[model samples]
Target: MISYLFGILSIKGKFEYFKMFLVLLSSLPNIDKRIKSIFQTIESVEDIVNIIIGGGAASLEKRASYSLEWLEQNGRCLDHIYSRLSDIPSAGRGAFSRRFIKKGEVVITSPLLAFQKSQLEEFYDKNNKIVPPPDFESRQVILNYCFSHPKSSLALFPLTHAMLINHASVRKGSNRHPNAKIRWATDHTETQKS
Candidate 1:
């Protein structure tokens, strides 16, 4: 992907340089003035590539260094809880805590990835009575799994460790978890204790 984006023959150790070039060019403070002053106009991808490969190399290197430095300072946001792992004899691993959890406290949060709602709609249009092609339902199940469990961060619900908790429905009037609650948004989810 990086090679494709950079259109390079051998991008040995210069990935960050190209990335910075793109970032700086697109995010120029005064894009119009900078573009006009620099090159008058960018006619084609090949021309841009040539410029990055030649005259803009030094600037790209500088911007890449700064971008990487800033990222190192404030890039990651992790470590929600530090808990112990408990194993059920015949079941699976689960995170447990001996600490007292206060009411309405957030226990876990995860960023959901790009969901495949459009693809799902394309395949299963219930309103029009259009089901996926025969034998496609099984494929869809696999796709959903992949979309939610990709190696990269494109999963529908990436790193859904909170999903390990059983959200079993109650039998009587209510059908939800009694002690814990889960909330979902367009691109993320939060698990809270009530």
Candidate 2:
């Protein structure tokens, strides 16, 4: 699935058909520039095979890294690492781990949606207060999901399933405990040294 856009089954007239498909895809306004360039530069079936093989290799490497990370940290690995329930008592859909994840282990890694100080102005009114809900619900929603400093407008929100994890209670006698944590993944060179 990495390279074969739409599973080329037959090679009888695939070269011309694939070329035409690439031409159409390249012309798409939303297509990535690098992919568009690749599509435009393809010369033959061998080129397509090379691209497909290269993409498959990269995909496999990425999966291998993720599996290795999970194996090192959790002692086991599963392709789909999480499960979501439609409802959990009073709580809405909750993110649950499909496998037993070790304490302090990374559940999922995703980039943060960092909002600049100036860009966050849209969430505030002229008086510099957070806009009220209903009318400005979208802005309020963004503020709710994002982590922002009171003195600064900078906000960082995880762009993945991590957001679905339920917040633990801080009150006494509550059964919930903060079992998970979030941290900025600064290093991608390799998994952290044991």
Candidate 3:
């Protein structure tokens, strides 16, 4: 299986990402329609690999959504944002910039699926026949386990589902750590406004 996946993506690191991507692709009901909606055509297997697992460039951020060719095909934005496997200490992955970003620049704004604590607790109570809202410690431990071992058991975590927003959190007590901030609202009916 490793060999087959590796063959699909010649890069070893990309092969590893391919495994996670496969997990994401399986959950989507209309995989074909989703792919068709995202892209105009599928030229080859390599094209799929490039489309799915990309952003391994060295010098500058590839500007096609991440490339010169993509910029030529698409146009230009004030700032080009790209996601890649992060190289930060004490980190798994995140987003990065290869160009200057303004003070109050809006990077990305996509709808995210969220479940409230109340609703989740009610659902669990109905299923398990226990009182709603389990103790905080128990819930924390379970959430920690799920987040820590996403590829192990919690395969449905937003990170693996391609729904995670890989924002670089501002490290504490450092002014230069993160100059920008993030603010989000929970309501799905309303689009997030700056």
Candidate with the greatest TM-score versus the true structure: 2
Clashes of each: 0, 0, 4
**Model 1 alpha-carbon miss at residue 153, Å:** 20
Candidate 1 — which pairs collide? none
lDDT of 1 by residue, 1-194 (tens): 11133434234444444433333333323234433233323334454444433333222322223387765763333234332222434222233433655767765654433444333333322234444332344334324333344455333523333423333324234544445666663332233433
- Evaluated at residue 187, the lDDT of candidate 3 is 46
Model 2: CA > 4 A from native: 1-80, 83-91, 117-134, 169-173, 189-194
Q: Per-residue lDDT for 38-102 in model 3, tens only? A: 32233344544453355221211322242677556533242255555554553334456657767
lDDT (C-alpha, whole model) for all candidates: 0.37, 0.46, 0.37
lDDT of 2 by residue, 47-93 (tens): 54453433312222222233766758644222334434423364433
Runs in model 1 with CA error above 4 Å?
Answer: 1-91, 117-155, 168-178, 184-194
The model with the greater lDDT, 1 or 2, is 2
* Candidate achieving higher TM-score, 2 or 3: 2
TM-score for candidate 3, please give it: 0.34
